[model samples]
Target chain A: MAYNDKVLEHYEKPRNVGSMDKNDLHVGTGMVGAPACGDVMKLQIRVNDAGVIDDAKFKTFGCGSAIASSSLVTEWIKGKTIDQALSIKNKDIAEELALPPVKIHCSVLAEDAIRSAVDDYRKKQKGGVNASGS
Target chain B: MNRVDVCWSCRGGVVAGEGFCPTCRVIQPPDPRRDHFHYFGLNPGFDLDLGVLDTVYRQRQQQFHPDLFVSRGATERRYSMEHVTRLNEGYRTLKDPLTRGEYLLKVTGFREQTPENATPSDPAFLLEIMEWRETLEEVDLKGKNAAMQLQQLRDRMMETCDAEVVTLGKGFHDWFVGGKREGLAVAAQHTDRLRYFTRFLDELDRKSELFF
Candidate 1:
């Protein structure tokens, strides 16, 4: 269980760990869990009207792998366009973090969280309404 | 270093040549005997309440966990590690019906893999399994009505599995406490059925993801 020094550093002092205002229409929040490990993760994105990710935050409760995965994603998503952010796959995250095979699920969880948050933002835009505070 | 033999019954020191201590008439032995159930303070049975077992397991883990002996001597630390490891192995094996049944068979010195004794007595049960498999395969082929059917089957199978587990628990009590050794064989048979059923359920779950 010797993690990369960078991964361990991020896991211990995770950046962008918090929540966005639920009332913000451009803010998208995603909460997901892995049943196998009983781990939960929440990823949020604040997107501008032009579909550009302006800010990102996350809260994760799980193993070091999970924490590092979500922290990496939050850093990856900020300042990217919706399309660019969507292209960030779990495999890429796993590769960058050098996640072990068993912990690849943590990367997959991060990918799903990003997709869920972006999808929520798109849904709100389609409905021409404010965020539902879900 | 001088060696001293201790009597089991009297706790009195005995000479090396002496077979038994005069005070208690107890023979000196190097190792103490321990039974699995007695070690865990449980009556050996087929049936167990997993919730209660979980609590007991955590409590015992707290008592014997290696983390608690981080500052202890090397010998004491090694002893604690070995004790906790065995406890974990025993708890895991005894918690599952299939493993428990296999353990009971091993304890009773029945090592043969008897396929003749494998099949369940209930023909309808086998038929039900076949039907579920057929439905699963059909769904895989057609890819329609899968979600609803899978959900229904999952719910029903889960309920049935829970009930069967409860019955297995009662069977354990019957075999271990009631002195009905024959019941152990019956419990083992049911455990086999439960194992197959669990595998099928897992297959269905994996197949369900295909539709999604």
Candidate 2:
């Protein structure tokens, strides 16, 4: 399928395609998958002491739409607070990317990844122990 | 597609599935709505017996072989061809554990290609996958005893896959018998993990072929 200009650009130059130290108490990691398509994604975020997300990164092994969706979300969440980042929705991502109807799931996957990473972060805070990394 | 209840050839009561018409010996067209298990009259759980599946497959093949229709009408020939294609496809899918599990999910409310934002909610499983990838990357396949090393790792992976298959089988049993949604979810997670392992195994095989 021919992706729109925005999706194409993001796919071509996907931003923050890497991993943060999962063991860091300030870092939260999320791993998600679409079993239907065998697509797996890992998204991570580093939060500051003030509860603001200082940075975000991702590594996704999936189709172009999936890659672009995760890339866009990482960029969007970088400067936002945890609560603000959780407010981000899949619809906005799909609209910005102009994703096809079938690939709307890619946007949903990105949104879930963000929530999961933040959830990991919160869990670690409550438990007072690092569980993401060895 | 609608389910056929009568034999097209003899106006006899046909089996409620896409299997061949028993009365007139006519090969029926494949029913898209019927799952592989229903097509073969097998249970929908994961604890399948290949011996039984093979027996049924061979019986179907013998009854509907395309050669049996060479002297028949064009319609008969077409039905024969469809029968052969679908029967073989169903057998191949049901014979493999990973494919069978995925097929079960597809037939039971899950879309075969529906991309969902929900990931398998198991952190330990995620960690295991990451470690596997790391170990695979760390292997030096060009060094001495590389072949043996690779063989050892392949064996280990297969062992894990087999264990996961058994786990998924019990999960399927629980879902069907106890009607637990949690059981289905566990089976789904195991199925997802199995898919990843299958892909990794295929990649490793390709790499080994190159090495040799």
Candidate 3:
């Protein structure tokens, strides 16, 4: 499928495509895989002591749409607080990239990754360092 | 090949293809309308005999291959071409365990391919996937005895896939026997896992080729 210009742009120059120290107390890591499509996405966020997102990074192994979605979310979450980051919906991402209906799941996955990351962060903050609480 | 015309062998009304027309001696051509199981006259379940499938495929190809219809008229030739393609597709879909499981999922009316579907909340499974990837990555990076290592990786992946396929088969059997929607959903999730495992296996195959 021919991706729209925005998706291709994101794919060509994906932002913050790497990993952070998952063990860091201030760092929250979200690892998710779409079993249906065999796509795995790891999104990590570094929260400041001031309760703002200090940085965000991601590494995804999947199709262009998935990669683009992850890349887009890293940019979206960088400056936002945890509460603000939660507001990023899959529909907004889908609309922003003009992802076709079939690729809407890619956007949904990005949303899931973000939420998972935020949840991880919250858990760590509440349960102290190295918390793997469910 | 559904038409109002009569069958050439038994003069029976249009009948869907199975092994052959039951009343007549003719090996019936494939029907586009029928699912893969009905196309091959097999019961709609994961448990299938490859021997029967192979023989039926060979016979169907022999009867309808375009090469055999070279001397026939255009309409007959067209029908043969379509039927031959359908038969080959049916054979391929049924012969593969992964595709066969997925085919059952679709025919069982659990057709949604949404991303939110079955993300595998089981933390143990997620951890297993992570370990599997870490192991495969180590194997991918090593240079010494790469072929042997890739072979072992491939074997491990195939073993995992086979186990998952068995699980999927059980899910299918449960649904077929007990008629539960949850059974089909669980089976579909297994199919999802099988597909994920196959992607890794395929990568291992590619690495093995490059290593050797």
Candidate 4:
């Protein structure tokens, strides 16, 4: 039950905690949940014209570990390319947060959220309104 | 507890429904390996007759009463303790609809936890969750109509959760009775929804507390 200092720190003062225009073409939304713990997380990234993550935000409803996990990832993904953001592993987040073995799933949820967000962005770019029917 | 067919003390054959060995009249340990339905001597499925379950539970409780073992041997007393423990635990698990479905899923070889990809695949469900969460955050606790609004939301959420439970039951029935594999996935998805709904209700309770 005891959380590490880093987790507590991020949880108490989560950075970039908000929402973006999900309908905007540049915005990618990732919604993930852990059924076992009943935790829901929504992570979003707004990619700039340069194909770099201009801003990232998240809203998580769960334990401190979950909130910290998403909060940390949102901060990490900012200014990075979508590919770079995709490379952020759950292990790295868990290691950085010093999350306990049981809380490792929180980090995994964050990683999945990022991947999902990126996938959404790619899908939007591919066949949606952006498609020119080539 | 592992010796289901043979008695530990008398080494005699133990018949089904016989708590004590027929040959030596010694209490036999309850089989720990037995599934909950098997423990209750019922068919494994989602739909259960609560009356039958209640009757069996009461009968087993009386048969394995701890007081009945006090005058018996040390081994018999130990077996009695084990029987009562597992009986209570099993009865509690099977008595609840949600827990009962989950237990059936476990016995049917479904993973209890989420997989490596913990994110829910259903975008619609995710959007609903997010919107509900946003609504929860948007409610002003200091407003005069806050209590009424909270009650309305709670009622709506409770209705949704009740529907999910029904769907979950049907999913289990389809898998166990109808012999459909896809039913397992349906049960799993609804179970996930129920958990989220439960959490949302808990948050509602917290918000109500803050309002009051």
Of the candidates shown, which would achieve the greatest TM-score relative to the real structure?
A: 4
Q: Write the per-residue lDDT of candidate 1 for residues B98-136, one digit (tens) a residue.
A: 677666655655444423212124435544554555566
Q: Report the C-alpha displacement of residue B34, candidate 1, in angstroms.
A: 4.3
Give one digit per residue, the lDDT tens place, for model 4 in B1-212: 34448777768788643578899888877765688888888888878898999999999899989898798889888888888888889889998766776677788888655453455668789789878888988888889889999999999998998899899989998888889988988988887788778889888898898765
How far is each candidate from the true structure, as Cα RMSD in Å?
18.3, 4.8, 4.0, 2.8
| C-alpha TM-score for every candidate | 0.45, 0.77, 0.83, 0.89
* C-alpha lDDT (0 to 100) for residue B10 of candidate 2: 84
What's the lDDT for candidate 1? Answer: 0.70
Best by DockQ: 4
Give the Å shift of residue A101 in candidate 1. 29
Please give the fraction of native interface contacts (Cα pairs under 8 Å between A and B) kept by each candidate.
0.00, 0.46, 0.40, 0.58
Give all candidates' CA lDDT scores: 0.70, 0.82, 0.80, 0.86
Worst 10 residues of 3 chain A by lDDT: A125-134
Single-chain TM-score of chain A, each candidate: 0.92, 0.94, 0.94, 0.95
For model 4, name the residue pairs that clash.
none
What is residue B54's positional error in candidate 2, in angstroms?
2.4
Q: Model 2 reaches what TM-score against the true structure? A: 0.77
Candidate 3 per-residue lDDT over residues A43-132, each given as its tens digit: 899999888998999887677999999999999999899999999999999999999998888898899888888888888888884445
DockQ of predictions, in order shown: 0.01, 0.36, 0.45, 0.60
